[model samples]
Target: MAPSPSSAAQHRHHSSLPTVSSAVSWLFLSLLFLYVVYYSTILFEPAPTFTTTTTTKTATDCQDISTIESNTTRVLRFDTELRHIAFGIAASSRLWRIRKEYLKLWWRRGETRGAVWLDKEVTTTENENLPDIHLSEDTSKFSYTNPNGDRSAIRISRVVSETLRLGMEDVRWFVMGDDDTIFIVENLVRILSKYDHNQFYYIGMTSESHFQNMLFSYGMAFGGGGFAISYPLAVELERMQDRCLQRYPGYYGSDDRMHACMAELNVPLTKEPGFHQNDVHGNLLGLLVAHPVTPLVSLHHLDVVDPIFPGMPRVQSIKHLLESAKYDSASIIQQSICYDKKREWSILVSYGFAIQIVRGILSPRELESPARTFLNWHKRLDYTAYAFNTRPVTRNPCQKPFVYYMSSTEYDKTREKIIGIYTLHRERYPYCKWKMESPEDIDTIVVLKKEDSSRWTKAPRKDCCRVLPATKNGTLYLWIGNCQTNEVIEL
Candidate 1:
């Protein structure tokens, strides 16, 4: 009585198909619900918020015009010297070219009265119109063959005594130098003015070469660079000349013998930064480019240094360059080099007379980084204080923007508590505003802003910046800030 087996099987298969479809639909709906819940939880979570607050601070009015006026007057007073300056030269044919180039300029200056002390008689034809000439044989009995095989020591050692005996009664400073030495007269006058002419001051700087300085007394002023003996000192030296020469008979160099005599007289060397005994031989562009803050007095051994300009004769060109710079010493000292491919430098003459090697060859990233400090120039008068106080922050700027910083040592605590900032390159930015903030106990933050961002980037930045007067043309007035004692800290 049951239906066929095939019909029963077909009915069962149709019923199973409906159950499988319903199960698949439920699984898909469950997965969709979980995905929706996960996404909704993420979307509903709190969003992070960032806030940047801009601080607006008023620029402090700190510049005092009267103080600057007084300082200028002081500088003017320091520039003049009442004493007569006399040049005593140790002459030799070996340095005839130097004599021709340097003496000619000295003659033209008319500020210096000069005389050449020679080992033998030299004619005008051979010596090139050099002023007064005296034979060394006629001067002093001190004579010895130096290990260096040069008679310069004997000539230099005796010249001082001979110059005084020759009736230089009116001469206040007897400057003894070799034929190769070139002196800046104005700078010499300014430097000598610092000391009393009546007192016996041996004003000279030590040798630039470490080896030479070590071999001889580091305290001794190398005579080739030239040294000045005050009238009073010269008188004492004259009295002890023969006696001192006999004492140091084995001494070959004039400087060592002079040192011995000075030691006996209890006259310590009064070192002046301007007098340079340049012993190194190479391109001197680095030396002259970053010249010290102090005035340049003299340059010795010119034959070794390269020419100042390209394609020009060394001696004549250097003399002309010096002559031009002599009139405007400030301009020469404050000179900043930006980009000179021919000269092989990018930015020359930084805060420490440092050279920045930024030729076209360097990448932008390399140029952006801080410059390497080249201390080819001599140590600053106060190396420790200078290094600690005037450390730089950025190297992007070539020339220093702020020339002056208020020194806690200079001003009294009761004096108007304002920091002074002076700018040398005012042509780039006429006005600048600065904000000072101290975060850490040791660090002080200074932010400088000008209307023109492009120009602001050129000015140099330092921790404790150098403070120089705005004497150059187009220089701007000083900027004063109400920075507290707590704000100024050691780096």
Candidate 2:
């Protein structure tokens, strides 16, 4: 078979073809092994997956369903109103009767939504203008080691969480307060509307006392003045607060515990000055007369402080102040400064509250500073303890202000303005020795006002006022409204 030349060439070609085919088969098997080794891990191993979680168990049924449609749905946004807030007011059986009156002042029976968490049951009058009452769950399982603090702190701390568990509909904010807390609801609605309820917000002010804030934290919202938690934050708190509270057995109060939980959740407090803890004692006239530029939201410890209006009872004085609030809530206790150039007089009008006239012209800086008319919470005589700047009552008797508290404020429909009549307080002061025309002779001040909270959306500014010409011999007139572009408050 190898002797013939053509047959030999064909046999040689056949042998080379077999060798080439054998090499191709070996390359194909090697490639198959390499592909199996490299790709088997990828084909059989697990892949990463994404998930959306909330502190809710109700959505478990919907977990398998695609979330695209739900996620892509339009978010509804609306202005925060009275109905959107759930007020969790902490009270005890011992103080319920007296404190319920304070609640009645602000609560509209059918309009407001919330429950008063009490330690024990209290009888409710029919058709009472108060929030529904509920007995707080026993908190004896939690430890409170602070010697001076009350164990009631545990139950109070759970009020927000308990309120969240109520499963309220369309709840945007969970507001917490003591039973004695006086809330200016209209102002609360106005201020809360400025924030986005969808985000986590711990909105409140710290204690007015520096010592109190230093002892606990400036970050803690003094619960007396009240604090607001966005619904999202409340829900998160409801999920873990029982465990959080158990961890902090040594915490002194509900507020500090709340601060600790917020810290754990990596949220910081947002301070607002309108919430006044009113930790100080005595007359609040000076504080009210020279309010910060912000709206007055809450006033606490009303029973401890003297009546806001001289010679009026605690409840009546609040009602007197609310008279103006009923007409123009955003402007209550809001300060405006202007001058009588002819008389060289400095005049201050605390809208819906009082009017103060001093004999000498003073700068805005001195006027804006709160006068030390009230004592500190500790009853310390030293003025340096205050958290904010304060001015001493003028030693010079003639320069001291002649005060006039608001006697009445009514909406003048025809005038399209509020006419507030501030009658002279006539508190006998050190008689003025220097010769000058006396504002004491002026029996009344009529404040003409136009709504000015339009400026609240931007940087908040104090409303501006101009001293109008005297309308009656014994009456002075002033007008308060938004500031003019070129106008400035100066001497």
Candidate 3:
């Protein structure tokens, strides 16, 4: 079986040559295939990039998916330079759902789609389910009555523009509104669609007797509550920015300024059934969308706390608002702690501050006075009660009489100061507590500072009451004199 070594070596060498050649051929084919694929992909599939092109030549027609067509109607809401976070949350969650229900019924008219729910704020998880939100970033470009007024308003305006670009860029008709606005959405949308596209459509509850008539009367001018505008009107309104800024070379409230701008442009504002303004009876504007719209637009005085209209009982809904917050224990202290009283106070103070700043009594940098800062921060109480990074301003009248807290000695001094102030302005300053219609208006309020249940106790007054000396070690008390109700045990 033995053969020559040279013969065997030659046979092995020949076999190895074919194996190497086959490997080389496979490598060449793979390189050629990859080159072809890379070129093909370059020609067919493009990389992501930005462009200035609009939707004019496209079948979808609009650059943004958010715009409505001529036959469509939208319900929009605006926010100004203020913190109505609690109200916004409440409206978006509770009232919006109500409006959606009405739209479901009213949208049946010839493909007259549902109303557009819009707001001028950065949408969050709390309101992500809400239909359309425009996150605004250029609100600072807009002016407000006071310096801080822009904080809420600018954010809102930025959001509004964003919403428009997103929803109405190619849409024909749309409605603008505030969070607290109330109306019959379905009916309004159906009615608005039956209008002339050539004409401006500004639909809301019109006032016949100017601003004096019950807020929801008939007038031609569009209401800030919820106004529907055609595509032309939307475009025209959007274009009014230059003139609007020029006309008011200073601070301006968004809603009122918008009305003023409309007037200047001579746009014929129209109306539909169920459009409303600031009527709080909750009865005047029957089930649709309700607005907490206007005050959020500009600076609010941080003094007027409490609801204006008695239509809705002042229920403590902060619990609901708080429950809606995400459970991030770390950031709990960083959130706004909104209080019912403080919320009212913020409105009053902001209103006054807005006026002052507009009238040149204050500047933006100095706008954050002790009182102003306190009120601004007070709004956070709604969602962060009993939770804090630092201790809350604890010191008398922690809940009632609307007075600041100081030590017992300081309380007396402050009380005397208040009495003296009231005495001096008694003719002009009326007592707020006695404005109630009845003696039975008293309700018990149990206020808590910490999570301890034992710390909770009944507020001392059984009737409409005011603050008093505490009877317990760490509790406060109140005495409802008009209703002759009084009990005390806690400090």
Best by lDDT: 2
Q: Which residue pairs in model 1 clash with each other?
A: 404-467
In model 1, where do residues sit more than 4 Å from their true spots?
1-72, 75-83, 125-129, 138-152, 334-346, 350-491
C-alpha TM-score for every candidate: 0.56, 0.83, 0.33
Model 1: per-residue Cα lDDT over 24-99, one tens digit each = 9999999999999999989998898855333332321111101122122112222224237777887776556446
Number of backbone-clashing residue pairs for each candidate, in the order shown = 1, 0, 78
Better of 2 and 3 by lDDT: 2
Off by over 4 Å in 3: 1-128, 146-161, 167-170, 207-224, 249-252, 280-491
Task: Please report the TM-score between candidate 2 and the true structure.
Answer: 0.83
- What value of lDDT does candidate 3 attain over all alpha carbons? 0.31
* Model 2, CA-based lDDT: 0.85
**Which ranking of candidates, highest TM-score first?**
2, 1, 3
Better candidate number, 1 or 3, judged by TM-score: 1
Candidate 1: clashing residue pairs, number: 1
Clashing pairs in 2: none
lDDT of 2 at 115: 91
